[model samples]
Target: MRFSHTGPAPARRDDWQTLKTLWPYVWAFRGRVTLAFACLLVAKLANVSTPIYLKDLIDGLGMPSTQLTVPLAALAGYGLARLMTGVFGELRDALFARVTQGSIQQVASRVFRHLLALSLRFHMGRRTGGLTRDIERGTKGIGFLLNFTVFNVLPTLLEIAMVTGVLLWRYDWIFAALTLATIAAYVLFTLKVTERRMVYRRTMNTLDSQANGKAIDALLNYETVKYFGNETYESRRYDHDMRGWVDSAVRNQVSLNLLNMGQGLIITIGMTALLWQSARGVVLGRMTVGDVVLVSAYLTQLYAPLNFLGFVYREIKHALADMERMFDLLGHHQEVADRPGATVLQADQASLSFDAVDFGYQADRQILHQVSFSVPAGGSLAVVGSSGAGKSTLSRLLFRFYDPTAGAVRINGRDIRDYTQDSVRAHIGIVPQDTVLFNDTIGYNIAYGRPGATQDEVIEAARAAHIHDFVASLPQGYDTPVGERGLKLSGGEKQRVAIARALLKSPPILVFDEATSALDTRTERAIQDQLDRIAQGRTTLIIAHRLSTIVHADHILVLEGGRVVEQGTHDALLARDGRYARMWELQQSRTAETP
Candidate 1:
C-alpha cells in the first residue's frame, strides 16, 4: 500500500511513532483534551465504586433482622454511582468530539496538500483509486484511534489498576495476584494472536485497494471497454482482487474468534479461582458474606474492561497499519520544489527560451536532445513534427512541468527556476492536445481557468473559442453538466472548452499542443481563425501535426527524433526543400486526396 518516489525509501513507522505523529494535531485543542480526560477519570471512579455499593446493598438485604428495613442507603448509593458513571462518560465523549474531528480535518488537509505539492512524476505512476482509498481509511483510523485510545484503552487500564488496588487493600494479596496474572495472560495471548493476524489484515487492505483501483480504472475507461466489449473481463479482473480480499477477511475473522475465545477462557478461570478463595475464607469464619460479594463484584467490574481492552489493542494496531500509507505519502520528498525566497515571475510580455536543453522522462530514454528555441515577446513560433518527435515536450518544458536535464529554460532572460512555480505557471496558458474537464457545469469548467471569473468574462472567452453558439442552443446552456471528464461532449466540443478556458486565463504566454486536432475540417478552419486572432501580440508556441495550420506562423521549427533539424519562416523553409518542405508536401497530398 506504499508508493515508491524519486528519493530514499520512506521510513517505516511503528505503532508508537504513528501515535506520536497524531499528538500534535490533537494537542492543538489541549484544553478540551484535558477536560475530556478529567471526565474520563471521574467516570471510571464512579464505575469502580458502583460494584462496592452493590455488594453492600446485597449484604444488607441478606441480614435476617435488617431484611425488612429495605437497605435504602446502600440502594440509593448504588443507583447514584451508576448514574454518575453514565453521565460523566457521556460528558467525556461530548468534550472530546471536537478534538477527534478537528485532528482528522487537520491531518487529512495536510495529506491532501502534500499530495498536491508532489511532482507530476509521482502522480503519473500513482493509482488514483488506491490513493484515495488510503486517504479515506487513514482519516477514519485517526478518529478511531483518538477516541478509543483515550476513552476505552486509558479508562480500562485505570479501572483495572483501581480494582486491583481495592482487592489487595480490603481482601488479600492472593486476590490481587490472581487478577494481575489473568490480565497478563489475556494481554499476552491477545497481542501474540493479533500480531499474527496482522498479515491477514494488511493483505485485506492491499487487496481492497487493488480491487477498488481496478473497478475505477475500468469505469473511467468505460468507452474503451465498450469498444472492445470487455465488460466481463473487467468484472473478472476486479473479482480477482476481491477473491483474495475475501480469503484474507475470512482468515482475519477466524483469528479474531481464536483471540476472543482465549481471552474468555482466561477470565473464566481467574474469576472462578477468586470466588472459590472468597467462599473458602467465609467457610473458615475469616470473611463475611459481604466480603465474598465484594470480591465477586470487583472481579466482574475488572474483567469487563479487561475484555474490552483486548479489543482496543487489536484495533489500535490495525489503525496504525492503515495510517502508515498516508503518512508515507506525506513523507515523499517533492521532486521539484521552489528554492527558498524564490521571487515571482515579473513579465509584462513573456518571452520564452530553452537553451541547449536535454530531458527524458527516464534517464535511459531521452525525449528531447540538445533542443534550443526561442519565441520573442508578441511572436508566434509553431513546431511541426510527427508524434513522439518531442513537439509536445517543448510545451512541457516551457510550462516547467519538468525541469530540463541540461541547461535551462528561461522566462524574460532569467532561469525559470528562479521564480516560484505558481508565478511561472500563472504567466502561461495552454490548450493541451488531450483536454480533460472536471465533471461540472460547462461554465464552471471554463471559469476554472481563472477561478472567480465573472459570468461576462466567461461568456466572452466562450464566444472567442467559437463554443458560445453551441452552448446557447442547449436548454441548460452554461449550467449544463459536462459529465465525468467531459464525456457528455464530443472531442471537438471539449477542445473548444479548453480553448475557452485558456482564453479566460489570458496569460502573457500561450501554448497550443495540437489544439485543433479534435475539430472537424470546417470547425478546424473556424477555430484556427480564432486561434490566430488570440495569438496576436502574445508569445505563442504551437505544436502542430498539420503543416497547413502553421503556414502563417512567424517562425516554424521542424523537430525529428527529439532534435531541431530545421528552423525558419514558412517561405524560407519551403525554398530550402529540406525536412520541413517534404513534410509540407506529404501533408498537402493527403489533404488533396481527402475530398
Candidate 2:
C-alpha cells in the first residue's frame, strides 16, 4: 500500500515572507536585541582599530636604534584593542542567547497548540513521523537564521564599510574601488549559485522526511511485518527512499564545493590586485612601508568575515526554506471553528438530538440521509447495525467532530455550533472501540480522564471497570508502564482501562462504542452491570456489535444502509419480528454454537 498525506496542500512562501513572520517572535525581546547590537558595534570598532595600532607600532620600530623610543604606547593600545574585541564579542553572544532560545520556544509552542486546535480530519490524514520532523527542522532553522543574520552577516557588512572608508582616506581611490567591486561581484555570484543549489537541499529534505516516515510506519506495525515475514520487503521499501536521499545529498555536496571554489577565487584575485597597488605605491616613493602593512592588515580583517558571509547567506536561505514549511502549517485553514460570540454549554443534564441530519466523509458518497434521532435527558439509546451501516458516524456527529451536511446537532435544545467546541465536549465522555493508551504508567493513563484526579479516585474507577484485580496482580500495579500504544497489555485490558477512564470522567453524557468487544462473555456481563449502574440518570448512546449488551436499553435504533429501519425497546423490537428479530436470532445462534 502506498502512503501519502491526503490533507490539503500547504501554501508556498517566499524567504522575505518567512523572515517577516519570524521577526515579531525575536522582536518581543527588543531590549536584549538592542543591547546585543551595542556590544557588537563596540567589538567591531575595536577590531578595526587593532590594525591601525599595529601599523603604528611597526612604523615606530623602523626608526634607528639610537633615535628609537620604546613605542610602548602603540604596543599597549594594540593589545587593549584585541582584548576589547574578544571581551565585547563574547558579551554580545551572552546577551543575545535568551532572545534566540526564547523565540524558538514561543514559535514551537504556537505551532504545537495550533496543531492541537486543528480539526480531526487534518490529523487523521497526517503522518506522525513526517509531521514531527518538519517541526524539529523548523525550530532549528529559526535559531540558525537569527544568529547568522545578526552576528555574522551584519557584522561583516559593518567591517567592510569601515575598512573601505579607511582605505580611500589613506590611499588612492584605486584601492577602495577594487574592494567595493570585489565585494559586489562576490555577493552576486554567491546569491546566484546558492539559489540554483537550493533545489538539491529541498529534494534532500523531502526524501529524508519520507524515509523517516516509512521507517517509523513500519516499526509501528512491526507485528504485521513479522506475521507476513516481510522484513526484507520493509527494508527495501525504506531503502528506496534512502536511495533518493543519497542521490540528492551527493548533488548538494558537489554544488557546495563549486560555490566554495568560486568564492575562494574571487578573494584571491582581489587580495592580489590590492597588494600589488600598495607595493607599487611604496616602490614609487608615494607611500611608506607602514602603508603597505596597513593595507595588508585591513585586507586580512575584511576578507575573513566576507568569506564567512557567503556561508552565512547560504545557510540562512536553507533555514528560510525549512521555516516556510512550518509557517505553512500555521497558515492551514481550520476546517471547523466556533462562531464569534459562541456561548458555553451550561447544561448539567444534557439532551442530544440530530435533526434531519445528513452527512458524508466525501461528497461523492452519502453515509447518512436525513437521519433524525433524540435522546432525552437521563435516557439511554442503543443503536445496532451491520458493518458500514453508519452506526459509528452518529457518535462522531454527536461529539461535533464533523458537522452535519444539511441539519443541526443540538444539545439541551440549542444548536451545538452555537457553543464553544471545548465546552460542548467537556459535558460528554466516550470509550472508543479502538482504545489507544499513551506510552506512560497505567496510573497516568487512568488519571488522564480527569487530570489532577487523586490516586483513590483512579483506583475506584479501575475497580468499577473490573480491572483493579488484574492490575493489582502485576508486579508494578498502577505504576506499570504501558509500552508504545499500550501494546504491552492485552486488548481486553486496554478496553477495561478505557472504560475506567470514561467512568472517572463522570460526564452528564456518555458514549460507549463497542466498549466490551474485546472482553470474554463473563467479563462483559460484569462490566455491563457496572455500566448500567453508572449510566443511571445520565444520557447514554451505545453503538454495539453484541446484541446482548444493549438488551436493556430504554430505546433501540436499528439502522440499515444509513437509514433507520426500526425503533423501539428490546421487547417491542422483538415483538415486531422483522429486522431486529432476525439480528437477535442470528446472534443467539452464533453464541450457542460457541459451546
Candidate 3:
C-alpha cells in the first residue's frame, strides 16, 4: 500500500498550523475563558495598584516622622489590598488550569479517534510506544499553550501597558521611556538567544523520539533478541541513541540558562539606572522619595512577567511542531480509499475472483503479476505456496487491504472496489496466522467478532470451535480473564479462541491463514471436524503450509514466485506429480516419523 505524505508534518511547515487550529478548541469553552479573563483582569488591577498604596503611605506619613496613626492606617490598607490580590491570583490560576485541562482532553480524544480510523497498513510500520508519545505530546503541548499564552503572557502584557501609561501620566516622561526601552530590549535579547536555544530543543526532541523508538523496538522484540543472544547488540544501540538525547538535552538547558541570566542582568541594570534618575529628581523636588519607591516596585512587577516569556516562547514553538506531526497523521489519505458513491453490500451469494490482478508494496517490485482465479460461490478452496509467494497477499487483496496496482478483484461479478471498505470487509471473516486477543474475559474475546451477540450464541460458537469445554472448565468459565494477547493460554488454545471469534462473526466468506498450523495432531483433528461443518455452507479460502490439512479442499492452487504452477483437486494434483505433490510427499514423510 502506498502512503501519501499528508499530515501535520507538512514539507516546509511544522505543527504551527495545528496549534493555530486549536483556537477553536479553546473557543469551545468560551464561558470558562471569559471568566478566566475577568479573573486575570482583577488580579492584574490589584497587582499593578499595590505599589500605589506604598506611595500614598510614604507621602501621607513621612518616614521617621513619628506619625504612628497615619503609618498604621496605610500599612493596614496595603495589607488588605495585597490579600485581595492574592485571592484573585489564585482564582485566575484555577480558571487557567480548568481551561488547559479541557483543551487537553478535547485534543487527545480527537487524536485517538483519528488514530483508530487509520488503515491497518499505516499501523504496521510504527511502534506503539512512539505513537503513544506523539498523542500525549500533542495534547499536553496544546494544554501548555492554553495555560501560559492566555493566562500569563497576555495578562502580563496588559499589566505592563497599564503600568507604563500610568507612570507616564503621573511621573516623568523619562521613566516611561526607560521602562519601554528596557522591555523592548529584554524581549529582543531573549528572543534572539532563545531562537538559537530552540534549535537545541528541536534536536533534543528528535533524539528523544529516536531513543524511545529504540527502547520500544527492543521490548517488542525481546524474545527474538534473547533467542538469538543479541542482548548486547540491542543494548548498545539503545545506549547510542540515549547518548545523543542526553547531549542535546544538556545543550538545550545550558543555552536556556544563559538566556535567563542575560535577561536578569539587563533588567537589573536598566532598573538601577532608572532609579538613579528618579532619586536625583526627588532631591531636586521634581519627584518625592515615595515616588522613587513606587517606580522601583513597579519595575520589578513589570519585569516579573517578562522573566518567563522566554520559556513560553520556546515552548510554544515546540508545541506547534508537535501539533503539526499529529495533524499530519490525522490527514493521511488512503491510496485505496473507497470511491465516491460507494455502496454497502448486502448479498452473500457472490463468487470471489482475482481478474488479471497485479500488485506490489513498492513500485519496482510486483508480488502478484496478472494473477487470475475464481472460487465459486459457497465453495471451499486452498492456496498453497512457500512464504512470500503471494498466497497471503492474495488473501489481503480479498479484503481490500491493498488495491491491485492493475486489473481488478471482483465479487458477485462486480469489482470489489465498488463497495466501501467497511462494506467489503463486513461480509468477510478472517482468522489470521497470528491471533491477537485483548486483555478481557473469555466471553468478551469470543463476542468481539459480533459485539451484540447473546451469551448462548457465544457459547455455541465456542462449542463449534471445540474450545467451549476447555473454557467451561476454567474457574470463571466464560468470564475467565484472558491476559494480554491471551498469553495465559497455550498456542492451540489461542487458535481455538480465534476460531470461535471468526465463527461468531458468521460472515458468508471465511478466510483462514494457517489456522491450524500451531496445533498438535490431536487438537488439529478435533478442530478439523468443526472446520468441515463451518465450510459446508460458506465460501472458504485457506492458506496453509501443511499439505494434509487441505487434502479435502475441493480445489488447491499451487503458487511459485508469484505465478500459479498447478491447480487441481488433491487426487488429480497428486497424480500430476507437480509442486503440490512434492510438498505433500515431504509433509507425509515428516508426519510418519513423528512419535
Candidate 4:
C-alpha cells in the first residue's frame, strides 16, 4: 500500500469563471441531468398554466347570474389542477435532488483520491482543520447548486418570461413594460446587494477557519497547554475568532434583509400599477370586472416566484464559490509521476549508494551539499550529525521520499527514481522517530508493515522487537486497542511497537532513526541487542543522536553543515580529535558522572 500526505485545501474564489470549470463534474452525469431537466420542464409548464386556470375561473364567475353551475364546476376543476401540479412539482424536486447528490459523490470521491496522491511537501505547508473545512464546504456547495439551479432558478426564469408575454398579449404594452421594468430593477438590485453580501460571507468563512485552526492546535498539543497552564489564553483566542465570525454573519444578515425589503417594495409598486390599469380598462368597457380580478391574481402569483428567485440566486453564487475552492484541490499537479514504461524492481540484491548528491528543501538553502556515500549490499552504515546537518535528509533520499536535486540515489545499482515509486520504496523499511500508531488493535498495528502477514508472523516480529511480553501481559493481549498514536503505551513501549512494525515488513533494507532515544539504559540495551541482530546481513542506515547507539557500525559517517566532515570506524574517529572526537569525549564524561 502507498501512503500519501494531503496538501492545503483550496480557498474560495470570487470569480464566476471558477464556476464554469466545475460544470464538468456535473456533465459526467448528463443522463440524470437530462431527466432532471425534463422533469423541470413539465413542472414549469404546470406552474405557468396555474395562473391561466385561475383567470378562467374568475372570468366564469363574473360571466352572468344564470351560469352559476358551470363556474362552480370550473372552479373545482381548477383547484384539482393546482393540487396535481403541486404534487408533480414536488416529485420532480425529489428526483432532481437524487440525481444531483450522485454527481456530488463522484466529484468528492475523485477529489479525495487526488488529494491522497499529493507529495509530503504540500502537506508540510498546510493545516489539517482548514483542509477538512474546505472539503466540507466543497461537497455541500455542489449539492446546493444542483438542487437550486435545476429545480428552482431555471423554472422561475421560465415562469417570468411566460408571465411577461401573457401580460403583453392580454392587457396592453403599459402592463407588460411595467412588469418587465420592475422585475429588471428587482434583479439588478438583488445582484448588487449580493455582491456585497458575498464579501461578508467570505469573511465569515475565513474567521470560521481560524477558529477551527485554533481548536485543532489546542487539541493536538493538549499536553503542552496543560503543562503551561494556558487554558485561559487559548479560550480567549478562540472567543476572539468566533466574535469575528459573528460580526461577519451579522453583516450578511443585514444585507439579506435589505434585499427582502427591496423585493417587497418592487412587488407592491408593480401590483398597484397592474390593478390601476385593469380598473381603468373595465371602466372604459375595454375589459370586465372579472379581468381586473384575473389580472390582480396572476400578478401576485408571478411576483411570488420572482421574489424567491432573488434569495436562491444569492445562495447559488455562494455555493459556486465553495465549489471553486474544492475543484482547485483536484487540479493540483502530482509532484511525482512514474516514468514511461517504468517497471517494478526484480532483483534480490540489497544495496544503496549516493553519488555526489546535492539537495535542499528550497533553492537557496542547501540541506545536503555534494554528499557522497555508499552502503554495501547487506552491510550497515551509520550516519551521525547534529541537528540541521542533513542526516534525516539522507534517509529520506534513500527511501525515495524525495529525489536528490543534483545526483542519483541508486538501489541495487538501479536509479531509484527510474523504477515505479511503489516498487522502489517497497523493499525499504523505516522506524520513524515520531512513533505514529493508529487507534487499532496491537495485532493490526504490527501487521501494518505487511498487510498480508499471518497472525504467527505478527507475533514473531513482536517477539523480536522485545515488545511481545508487554503485549501478552495486556488484558486483551494482541487484541488490545492502542489509543491514538499509542498514547496509552509507555514511551519505550511505543518505540518497541514501531520497531516490531518495521521488522514485520521484512524489507531487504532496514533503517533505524535514533530508535532508542526515548528508552532508559536497560531498555535501550535490550532493544539495541535485537536491532544489532536484525541489522546483520542487511543493508542498514542508522541515524543516531546518541553516539553509543551506532558505535559498533561497520562504517560511520559524520556530517556537519550539509557536508561529510569525518568517515571511519569509532576508534579512528576518536583519534581525529575533531567534531566526532568532541562528541565522544562528551559521552565519556557523561558516562563517568553516572555514579
Per-model TM-score, in order, reads: 0.95, 0.97, 0.89, 0.89
Best-to-worst lDDT order: 2, 1, 3, 4
Q: Which 10-residue span in candidate 1 carries the lowest summed lDDT?
A: 1-10
Q: Which candidate is the best by TM-score?
A: 2
Candidate 3 backbone collisions, by pair: 7-328, 8-324, 8-327, 8-328, 15-324
Q: Which pairs, if any, clash in model 1?
A: none
lDDT by residue (tens digit), candidate 1, 514-554: 99999998999999999999989999999999888999999
Instruction: Summarize candidate 2's per-residue lDDT along 547-570 as a digit string, tens digits.
Output: 999999989999998899999999
lDDT values of the candidates? 0.89, 0.91, 0.82, 0.82
Q: Alpha-carbon error at 285 in model 4, in Å?
A: 4.1
In candidate 3 the C-alpha lDDT for residue 245 amounts to 69
The regions of model 3 sitting more than 4 angstroms off are 1-15, 63-98, 348-350, 452-456, 475-484
Query: lDDT of candidate 2 vs native?
Result: 0.91
lDDT of 4 at 361: 87
C-alpha-based local distance difference test score of model 3 = 0.82
**Residue 9 local lDDT, model 2:** 23
Steric overlap count per candidate:
0, 0, 5, 0
| Residue-level lDDT tens digits of model 4 in 316-350 | 88887676667778778777667798889865658
